[model samples]
Target: MAVATGLKQEQVVAAAASDNALERLHALLTEDLRQVNALIISRMESPVPLIPQLAGYLIASGGKRLRPLLTLAAARLFGYQGDAHLLIATAVEFIHTATLLHDDVVDESDLRRGRESANSVWGNQASVLVGDFLFSRSFELMVETHSLEVLRILSRASAVIAEGEVLQLITSNDTATVEADYLRVIEGKTAELFAAACEVGAVIAGCDKQACAAMRDYGMALGMAFQIVDDVLDYSAVQAQLGKTVGDDFRAGKITMPILIAIAKGNEEERAFWNRTLERQEQEEGDLDHAIALLRQHDALDGAMDRAREWGERAIAALEHAPESVLKQALADVIAFCIERDY
Candidate 1:
């Protein structure tokens, strides 16, 4: 089910995007990630058995756990020498998992991380309530850290993520959605948590404001790059590796950057097609192919990747402000994984 829109995963990851970045990072952070996993499992437990069952369903499903890894890696970069990084990393993961539950409910999505989404299995109400439980559990972890700053950073990120989700809801199915609007939505939804994840790592390490800012910048840039690449992959990647089926965005009428660029650059006939498929919700057979054709004709997906690359470069540059360490270099490698994964 790879979108045969004429762009293959091989074509997309041809040059800049390297899979080794994640592998290297994983190897570098193996022990710390193991601890984070144990913390995640232990914290997911609740008196109510359903909570752990539903949470465990998705938790056991393989996600790379990249955000928590970022937290641990950032803390390690600053020579943090305590167990707090482990706790904070687990908390960051809980926040992310909560968002995923809510997002699947919002999207009415049946699939997640290449399997049945939690919402699909447990019903939306269960999925949402469990998500809330995870969020609450995360705050408990934050309280255990006893750092007001860490709590403040994560709480703000949670609020921002809510705003982003709300904004995306408002804009969904609107072909008129603009690039600025799309970027803003992703900033709130994707990048804010990433920034917080890395920032909290630095905070726990007692890094100064400058080092904290550097980690934030790195995370933000990587998040932006990661999201844009994901959007492109919706139309250009192997469906097996895409975490969701191809053309899910288009079918949902959720206007993404590729669609926006095409709308801006396409001719009148092409515009009508977008309006019918997206705005009018009048999709017909062959629409995915046609959408892909328009995107390819306009080179919109390629253009979107270029923007992702620019952000990746910024992510790499942000690392320079932090003191050099193997962890820092691993974070840099994450930038490559963000940008160049299956184009």
Candidate 2:
């Protein structure tokens, strides 16, 4: 499909393939990102040593900061001039960091961003408490924006994210989960924050309702595409390039898109394998390899990637009418990057 600016899906993919789109965006928003980083560091401070110590570990860990970058770029796209975007961007990062801390604890994850996870280093209690502190700090930043609309968008996203996590917990290890259920889980957990982050930028910029809605749609679709690609990489990417082990999802019994598709396409024997490995959590030495084989045998990886690209197309389409600018083009290219990135 062609975007309002006449950019086609293939063109977006071609642009992403030719350049480091994310780096280009970071270069454009270098100053704003610097300010956002400074605000994050300043707000992370506290008299309690462990609070900052633990929170700082995860916050300073290598992350792309894509959500906050979206906020900054979106505001710039709409001609926002004031510093409110900085505070909102900082808040967006804090919220994302808090979710990471909590997710590590929930997932029993020992590593994050290729390093020891906060919960692994500091224990679950401390991680959970620091996550709470960051959540509170995020709200404080939102309040600083003084836009009730921004507060509403982010607060509701926070709640929805929690709900999504709970839903995932419910569906975990259950091979019967339909695609719709998985979509809802991701929409709440991941896409909601992305949507809120971009929408907050538009709202703070005093954009019209239609512009705000467009940004929200862009973010939500982008987030969906991003998470789907992430799930695909867990099974398809090389362990060295993937940052984490390739079979972490399999070990955890998480039912991602590849697994769901495999289950749907497999025969009775394959379903039995899933039951034994995922539902019962009785994985043997070569179970991961077997699982990977099943995925490939059924073309599950390709199927999931096709779904991701569909979301990427929707994301690009959402910004069809956005003013043609470097930032807008960067936003469009990032959709392709999210879908095409292997690591």
The numbered model that scores best in lDDT is 2
What tens-digit string does per-residue lDDT give for candidate 1 at 10-90? 433331243477766666666778889999999998899999999999888888899998898788778787889888999
Off by over 4 Å in 1: 1-19, 240-244
Q: What root-mean-square deviation over C-alphas does model 1 reach?
A: 7.7
Candidate 2 per-residue lDDT over residues 1-343, each given as its tens digit = 2232222345445444556888767766777888999999999999999999998899888899999999998898888889999999999999999999999999999999889999999999999999999999999999998999999999999999999999999999998889999999999999999999999988998999999999999999999999998898888756556556788889999999999999999999999999999999999999999999999999999999999999999999999988887679889989988898877
Q: Could you say which candidate leads in TM-score?
A: 2
RMSD of each: 7.7, 4.6
lDDT of 2: 0.90
| Cα-based lDDT for every prediction | 0.86, 0.90
Which pairs clash (backbone N, Cα, C closer than 3 Å) in model 2? none
